[model samples]
Target chain A: MQERLGKWLLSWPPLAYLVVFFLLPSLIMMFAAFRYPGDYGGLMPLTSEDPATGKLVLDITLDNWRDYLTLESFVRLVDEPLYIELFIKSLWYATLTTLICIAMGYPLAWLIARSPKKYRDLMLLLVILPFWSNFLIRIYAWMILLGPQSALSKAINLVVTAFGHEPVSLLFTPFAVIVCLVYVHLPFMVLPLYANLEKHDMALLDAAQDLGASAWQRFWKITWPLSLPGVYAGAALVFIPALGMFAVPDIIGGTEGIMIGNLIKQQFLETRDWPFGAVLSIMLTGGVLLMAGLAAAVGRGKQKAKQKHG
Target chain B: MAKRQSWWLWAAAALAYVFLYLPLVIVVVYSFNDSKLNAEWVGFTLDWYHKLFNNREMLVAARNSMVIGVVSALAATFFGALAGIAMHRYKLRLLPFLVLTPIAIPEILMGVSLLIFFVLLNVTLGMTSIILAHVAFCIGFVAIVVRARMQGMDNSLVEAARDLGATPWQAFRLVTLPQIMPGILAGGLMAFTLSIDDFVITFFTAGVGSSTLPLQIYSMIKIAVTPEVNAISTLLMVLTLCLIVLVSKVSPGALRAE
Candidate 1:
């Protein structure tokens, strides 16, 4: 009985705190999506005081509920193609970033995993150190590097001009956005891929090699197939955060590149349309949840197939 | 086992490291540049560092971040250690969900929803709310670290303490607490760095005059980012790097445990 009481004492504080803070707020955001935008910056009131009773009453009526709340936010999202296009563009950027992270991080993760044990820790630290630095600072570094007068920009523009083309600015283009996104998310990819790659049995590779398999075949047959779980984990880590990213585009994307995150920010702060913001947030949340569910199902199916084969 | 690595892998990995380090190297280097252009190096100077120290608003933001970092770390470590203990001991479904969801979700979701929730509750959007918001997310990280530490510990010691006529509290006080102290300390440092480095959540939740260092850096981006911004960023990076090293020292495998 005493130990059971101790267990309850240990659990309830975090459980209650999270229920109030994390879970409740998410539920509220979902609820806010169905409400109407206020004339100012809040949601329209769904309740009011009754003069006679001096008590609160539900202002939303069956006849006049439309006055208080509506589905306008979702309607607006569908009615206009602009938001859809922005979401699509964000998806493309995230997809490209994930693919790039895989291409770049694969070699680095492999190298670190295959390194001498004494140096492995140092190498992994070097990879994640820049990531631990301030996020704004990292983007700000790019802002300077990609600025028109910076050496990189000047060199690229010089080449373009020599080729009889107009000078191109790198700072505010889609290229800059993708570059920053990949830079920000590269560590997420490397860490998981390394964790997965580190556990591979080298004897399997040696056997494949002794059987006259080329390095490419050895990698494709052994390493690649085994690394699928890592790839999935890394891809999820990079893709979700990249999908909703606003800061990269806000600072360096210029006029050309904007995503769903920029729109969500606008609705809450700039536009002061809470319901629309809630709606956009709900769509984003739903999309993320759906993709996550799909991935889990696919992963489970693969697990089942492997178990059956065994 | 003879490890065979190809030449292309070495070149690719070297280039990857360059990509990771170059921007930071430039940021640190250009802070000392004499020119305001941030374009090319004319000559090195300490003027940016001097100017950064003299900037009052920047100092106030730094102080605020320090206070927030310390307070939230304490609060998060206390609660997170409890949660971690519960997770290790009990067959908990809800506890893990609550603890881990905040870490997995996109940060902006937390930022916006907290904004709405605070406004709805009529709470002022300021340091307290920001701390509340931070602790919500931070609990997950601290819990994960502590739980990972707990996983490696042997059960016999605790059981032996209990069987030796010590009460449950005495057993916990003497045996378990000493073992987990390093984990608690490491979790505290992680929470401190995360609260200090946080920007997205802070952006939505901050009101007038409650600017943090990251918010101050961001506000500068709208106007202009001079070398002064670079100076503070360089300092913040060094500070966080130190804290991370301390964490690694306290618990060598803490970073990879999660």
Candidate 2:
């Protein structure tokens, strides 16, 4: 009895707290998505006039849900090429960012993991320390660097003058947005990859080499396969948040780089279309969850197969 | 021959460090620049820092951020420690997964959801609501850290205490709490930093008159990039770095690569 009471005392507070503060809010938001938008930025209720008393009574209806579920919103989303283009563009940006992160992060992670033990923590700190700074300020730093009249641009322009070429515009462009995104998320990719790579058994490589396999062949057959979990984790870490990113694009992305996150922001703040924004939020959430699930499944499958073989 | 090839790896790592630090260095260096705008370099001056000190709104926003960060961290630590201990000590199914939902959900989704929730509840959006929203997300982080710590802890110590005639509360207080205290403290520090640096969720949940530091910096930047912003950014960066160092000191492997 005492143990059960102790368990209840330990568990119930956080469970109740989360249900009220976190889970309840999510449920409300999901429910609001199906209801008609109220005049004041929430769900609306149906109302009808009472016949005998001549008084109006409020009621709930599935009409708002039916309106959205009738294929209109989805069709509208399809017909609107801007939405489609933004979705595709966001995906392309995330993919490119993930690829760049892998290219940059893999080597860096390998170096840190392979570094002398005494200096390893310091090196990792160098990577993580800057992330402590405000993310917006970090993005703003890029703005300063890429500004047309800034020192970096002037130096580049000075070199261009020797060749009689024009100074290039760099700020407020898709290139700038991609650079910032990669800069922001590179650590996420590197950390997990480093965690995986650091534990790798070097003896396997030495054995493969002793068996007369080339370094490239050893990497492909042993190291790459072993690092698959980390690759998936790093990719997921970069890809999901990048897919839903708004602030980076909002700040650095010019007209050409608007994403779905920006669209959702506009709907809530500018358009004041709460239900539509909810729909977009739900879709983005669904996409992110799906990606995370797929990554988890793939990791499990690989582990199971490895267990079978080993 | 292998050493020669490995030099390329070292060079790539060097370049990566340079890539990461270059922007931060620019921000810090330009904070003292006499230039009002970011485009050009003027002679060094402390005018921006002076202006930052005199700015009332910035100071208020900073105070608000600190208060919210501290309060939310405390709240999250208390609740998270309880849940984490329970989950570790008992066979409570389904609760762990539910706790993870807040972290898994996108920040924008969480932000909008909280906004809608507050509006529906007829609660005025202010510091209280913002703190609640922060605590909601921060609990999961703290819970995860504490749970990891508890899972690795030996159970015999608590059993030994109980066998020696200590009550359940006394056993936990004397044995379990001290063992997991570092994890709780580390989780609190992380939660504090996360709250202080948060922008998106705070943006949606914070209505008029309750802007946090990041929100303030963002609005200021939207209007224009001034040297004052750089000074404030440098200050915030220093504060965060100090906290991270303290966190590392508190728990050696807390911020390890994993």
Candidate 3:
């Protein structure tokens, strides 16, 4: 029928795009991770390799997985003091950045959502304008600003001299890493919080106030509870990617500190260890998905509890 | 009433703004700094801007990024428009989750997998490959934005257009297109920005010689930071700002509308 044909045409384009480009490529790549290259740099099937050729003998062996799970490799990657220390450092940095973003963004979102219609656009623009630029450029700018001789450092030194205090080294540390991550991801945090906050029915707060509740009381009871979804959303948005971040640490974290993302990058590009790189990618992906899954479960549980209590 | 309302919120907001804009402000200022140190402000000069304009390599990278951006934006918009329509008009089971999986996948995994896939196929990575990669990720963004517009659309307009004996294409072109054009434009601009700004994925999928602006910047930074780079970044920031504004202005209620 013409109708059926029309419907098929309507859906085919997008479906084909997703299937061909996104899904197929990803599946192929995942499969490639399981095999080694042949003479033509093509993936060979299991049992197809000639014993004499020794060209990445593709026996569908568990060698790749075994290599990753070996005690030495495990010790090197996980038990190694440096990787564990850096992982902890990265976790805390991401945590601090997430907290800072929430602390900064929530009140701003509240202000924008509550402000008069005339000034709302101005406030939102201020919040989002920084994100308009490239993320790398922003971090690079931070490097310029926070470097020892930079204007910010110079200004702080001047003040420190005035007060007879020592000028602090703020750049090239965990402090700088957190600052950069918060700066870059702040808008992502703000936008979602703004969305959730703006959706709050003003009349509910009015009712809370009408019940002789103090302004702070109304905020704690009504506003805070209402915006918790946004807060969680904002925190997750900042925290998830911040953990896997590469450039910020590379540009600003200096030699002493590095993120796992940087390690993954090094493995792939600098080290030229494709198999190890694939394993690391899988691990990092697993970590992100695990965290996201936990967050979702917690969110659902909280919602269910709230429903029951209400 | 005066006692009940504290200026704490306002103060917090001001500090947050300061934290956010200080680096950007420094970047803009240092782009015109007379000296190369990027530390001290020697004097204002247009020398770096001039250098940026004269650099052929930088210009080539910028061109590559622009080409990728435009192609990806248009492709994403087209496919995303259809996906959005399918999600909205047709109640296809399991389609929503399928569309969303692309976003959930860590961008690094997506990048690595695609790299491996291209290598397996003996496909040389180039501008075309970059465009393909850009579109793959950008489609999800386009879908989300277009879906937002679709949700807000009143269905009656489409029905009325159909009732008036307009063909399906005519109905889409005349009624649906005009209504969602803002969303499409917004999505397209976002796609362009994201594509141009991307480095990591591009680094993985892009061929050895195919240097996007971000890739070039990445390599340059790896060598060493430069004030000339600052000047380039400042220009990029300004351009991105203009594009965001243009897109936002077109799409009223586009911000936080989703």
Candidate 4:
């Protein structure tokens, strides 16, 4: 009993903090997703103050709940094609960002993983240092570069103009959104990939070379296969943040570049539709969880097949 | 032959580094440029810096950010160290899930949910709500670091101390804490950085007249392309850079923790 008490004592502060702050808030949001929006802004109160006792009473009725509380938001989420389109576009942008991160991150991770031990820490630090700055500042940096008067824009437009094409505006486009997303998420990809690559054995490569396997062939047969776990890890780290991203799209994403996160933000702050906002948040969370579950299942299946083959 | 085989790999990595650093270099360099366009080299001036220092709203926002960062970091560190120790020792299943979910959920979900929560509880929304939200998220990061530091530690040493009649507090102080102190310190630094740099959650929970630096920067970015924003961004960059160097020096292992 004393030991148990000690355990409880050690664990309760954070456990209680999370229960009050994190878990309860989440359960509230999930519950509120089906409830009616308040006439002013937030959720409609489920309780009412009784004048006789001056106490808050549990006044949610079967009639009220069935008619209004549970109908509007979920129905709107399904009935509106705009929300579905926004959701799919966000997923697309996130998936594209993950792919770009992989393409760019692979070479950097490999180089650092193969670098001399004395310089490895410095290289890794260099990769992470840029990420530590307020990410808005980083996005702002992209804004300056992609703006109309910047050299990169001028150069690209110069080529287009020479070819008898109109000058292309870059900022506030989906292109700008994707670039910022890749920039923000690249460090996440590089770190995990480096960790996995660092542990790879060189003997297999040397032996493969001795057998007259070309570098490309050797990489495809050994290094690439060995790095799948890291790639998956990196992909996951990139995708979730990218999927839920709003700030990138909000600042750089123009009329055409808005995503589901933008809509969710609008519902809460601009539109004052808390129920719809809650609904959007639940959908995004549920979709991510569903994808994660599917990925885990596939991973398990792969492991089982490998075990059987071996 | 060795050189010939690896040039392309080296080239790709070099390009990636340039891509990573060049935009930031432009931002820093332009802060010194004396042009409204923020594109051309038209001599240098400290005009924006002067303007930023005089901006009362910017000063208040910076002060708010500093206060929130320190308090939330302290609360998060204390709670996180406990969570970390308990998790490592007790194999607490529920704690890990609670710790990790905040890290995994999108910032917007957490933002809206907490906003709803504060409204429901009639908690006055401002610095207190922002700090509560920050600590809630930062505990996860600090806990992860502390847990990482606890891994590979000499548990037997603590057990031996206990066997030699040391009290739980004494065993912890002498054997366990010193082992994990670096982790705890590093975790605290990380929590501070995360809190100060957070924008999305702060946006939702910050009531009227209570703006943090990132929220300030966001509003500025949305409205105007002022060099004042550049000046503040440069200052923020330098501060975060210092913190990174400090974290590396204090606990080099923590750099490798994540």
Candidate 5:
């Protein structure tokens, strides 16, 4: 009995912590999403709703869900030219950023991974060192660089002037936002790629070369294929956060660039349209989940084929 | 050894590093600029930093953000360490799967859901609410770091401690804690950094009166661009970069060195 009591006490810390803070609060929030608001825009208790209220006053109606799921809302979202454009723009930005990260990260990861054992640890630390800074600060710094009177802009203008061209406007646009996002999230892409790439054996590359395979052929056949898993993981890592990014776009996007996350923020904060905002949030989340599911499925299929071949 | 084409790879990496650090370099330089435009090459001046220190609201906001960051980091590390221990020692039903869901969920959803939750519970949004939100997100990061450390740790040490007539608590305190202290410290730093950097969720849930530094910066930037902002931003960037370097120097696998 004393032993059982000791075990229970030992378990109490984590269990009590999560249950009180995480589980309870999350459950309450999930439930809050269901109920209707009463006077003063407060949520009425779920069990105390009227049954036969046709006037839709102080009653439980599936109104929020209906408002979200209706064809009109769908059509309204779909018909809006900006929504689809922003959605597509978001996809392209995320995809392009992921690719760039891979292109840049793979070789660096390779170099660091295959470096002399003594310096390899130091190299890896340097690569990840930039991430410790606040993410917002980094993005904010980009604004200073790309702004009209900033150092980067001034330097570029001088170079262009030497080449006999007018100073070009580069800041406060989609290009600026993409550049900032890619720079900010590059560490996320690199770390995972590095982790996986470090696992590949050096003997395989040597074996391929010993078999008289060309350098390009050996890379395409051996190195690239093996590192594809990391590439996929890296892509997912960059793409997921990039898709839902807001602060970067809001800061750097200025006029020409805006993403779906910005729209969601506007709905919630500026517009005060809670129902519509909730619907948008649900849709955006659903879209991301679907994309992630599809990516996972593709990854699984490729892994299965690799397993079969091996 | 098979030598591959390394030129392109080297160029790409060099370019990438330059791209990553250029903005940071610019921020550091512009912080001392005499000109307010942040574009022109003005002579060095510490006036902005002087103004930043003297400003009452700015000082208050910085203090508030620091307080929140310290509290949230400690809370997150405490809870996260407990969770990691639970996960390591026991095979609790549904705990692993449930914990992983927060990582997969969109940040905005978490933000909105928490907003609704607090509204329903009639809890006022303020410093405590912001701290609570920060801890929720930060715990996942701390748990992941601590769990990784736990994985490499030997269970025999705990067994040996217990066999010597130590309580479970004593065994953990003397045996396990020392082994994973680096990871725990690294995780705590991560929590501190993440909590300080957060904006989206905090923006949604922060009370009317409680203004964090990020929230403060966001509002300032939205209205107009100022050299004061450039100065503030530059300071922030340097501080963050320094923190990252410090953290990396302490932990073996904390930062990927290049």
Candidate 6:
């Protein structure tokens, strides 16, 4: 009995802490998503003002919920071509960033995994060390590098001038935003891929070679299949956060590269429309969750197939 | 174990490292640049560093961040260690997911939700609220690190203590506690760095007259990229690097465990 009580005591602190701070806040946001916006910023009463008190009384209604659930927001999103364009633009940027990260990260992860044991830790540290700095400062560094007056842009301009073309202004462009996003999330891709590749058995490849399989065949039939999970994990890591990223776009994207995250920020801080912001928040959360669920399902399916084959 | 040396792969890795370090090098180098504007290559000087020290708002923001980081790290470590041990020792179905939700969710969502939560609760947003928010997210990180450490520990040692008539509390205090001390310290250090570096959540939850270093840096950068901002960024980066080094030295396995 005492031991059981002690176990409960040990578990309850974090559980309660999370409930009060983390879970409760998320639940509140979910509830707020279903309520009407007040005149200024916060949620409003569902009913009209009381005549005796001349004050708005607190009540529950699905009016706010219905506004979103009935596709009102979706219609608004459709009606506004800018929002749809931004959504597609954000997806395009995120997809390009993920692709670039994979191109750069896969080889790096492989090299690190294949490196001698003593140097492995140092290599991994190098990958993570840049992330120690403030994210804003890192993006600022990119701004300096890509600025028109900076040496890099000047040098590029020289080449373009010699070629009878216009000077390159890289700052405040979608290309700049994509570059910084890839830089910011490259480590996220590398870490998971490294973790996955480090434990892979090379003997399987040797066995395949001994069985008269070509190198490409061995990789296709063995290595690629094995690394799919890591690829999916890395993709998810890079994709989800990249989709909702605001700071990079806000700093470097200018008006051309504004994403849904910036729109959500505008609603909450700029427009002070908490209900609309809550609606966008719910949509983002739902989308992220759905993507994660799909990835997990695919991963599980691959796992089962591998098990059956083995 | 001799394998073919892939020069192309090594070159690619080298280039990747360059990409990662280029911006960091720029920040550090520009901190000493004599020019106020970041455009020109002026002679080297320490004026920015000097200004960084004399700036009142910057110092106060740094102090606020330090206080919040330390307090939240300590609080998160305590709760995280308890929960980590509990999860390792007990079989709870939903506990792991609960811990992971904060980490997996987007920071904007967490920030906005917490802001709403504080408003609904009628709690003033300031150092206390920021610390609470930090602790809420930091707990998951600490829990993950500490739990990874505990997973590799010998279960028989705790069981033997119990068999020798040690009370549950005593077993935890004398046996299990000492074993996971390094993990707790590592987790605490990580939490501290994370709190100091956090911006989005802190941006939303920070009330009037409560600017942290990241907030100060953001405002400064938004206006212009001055050498003073570079100085502060260099300082913050050095501080985080030192803490990470300390964490690695304290628990070499902690990084790999994550």
Worst 10 residues of 3 chain A by lDDT: A66-75
Q: Could you give me the TM-score of model 6 versus the true structure?
A: 0.94
Q: Pairing residues by index, what is the TM-score of model 4?
A: 0.97
Candidate 4 off by > 4 Å: A61-64, B1-5
The better candidate by lDDT, 4 or 5, is 4
Q: Per-prediction DockQ scores?
A: 0.80, 0.65, 0.58, 0.77, 0.46, 0.74
**Residue B196 in candidate 3, Cα distance off native in Å:** 1.6
Clashing pairs in 2: none
DockQ of candidate 1 relative to the true structure: 0.80
What are the runs in model 2 whose C-alpha is more than 4 Å off?
Answer: A40-42, A45-58, A61-75, A155-167, B1-5
lDDT of 2 by residue, A37-138 (tens): 667764554465789988977554565446433344445566888777877788899889999999999999988887778888899888988777899889
- Tens-digit lDDT track for model 3 on A1-310? 7667666776788788778767787666545444443434333334444778866654445665542233333335566577667666777888888998988898889888888778877888888788768878888877877788766788888998899987877778877888889889999889889888878888887788788999889989888987888888787778878888888888788776588778867765666555455656666766677778876887788799899999
lDDT of 3 at A226: 78
DockQ for the candidate 2 complex?
A: 0.65
Candidate 2 chain A weakest lDDT stretch, 10 residues: A65-74
Pick out the ten consecutive residues of candidate 6 chain A with the lowest summed lDDT.
Answer: A65-74
What are the per-residue Cα lDDT tens digits for candidate 3 across B169-235?
8988999989998898988888898898987689888997689999888778767777888888888
Worst 10 residues of 3 chain B by lDDT: B1-10
Kindly report the fnat of each predicted structure, to 2 decimals.
0.76, 0.66, 0.58, 0.74, 0.42, 0.70
Compared with the true structure, all predictions reach lDDT values of 0.90, 0.85, 0.78, 0.90, 0.73, 0.85
TM per model?
0.97, 0.93, 0.88, 0.97, 0.86, 0.94
Q: Candidate 4 has which clashing residue pairs, if any? A: none
Error of 3 at A19 (Å): 3.3
DockQ, structure candidate 5: 0.46
Judge candidate 1 at residue B20 and give its lDDT: 95
Better of 5 and 6 by lDDT: 6
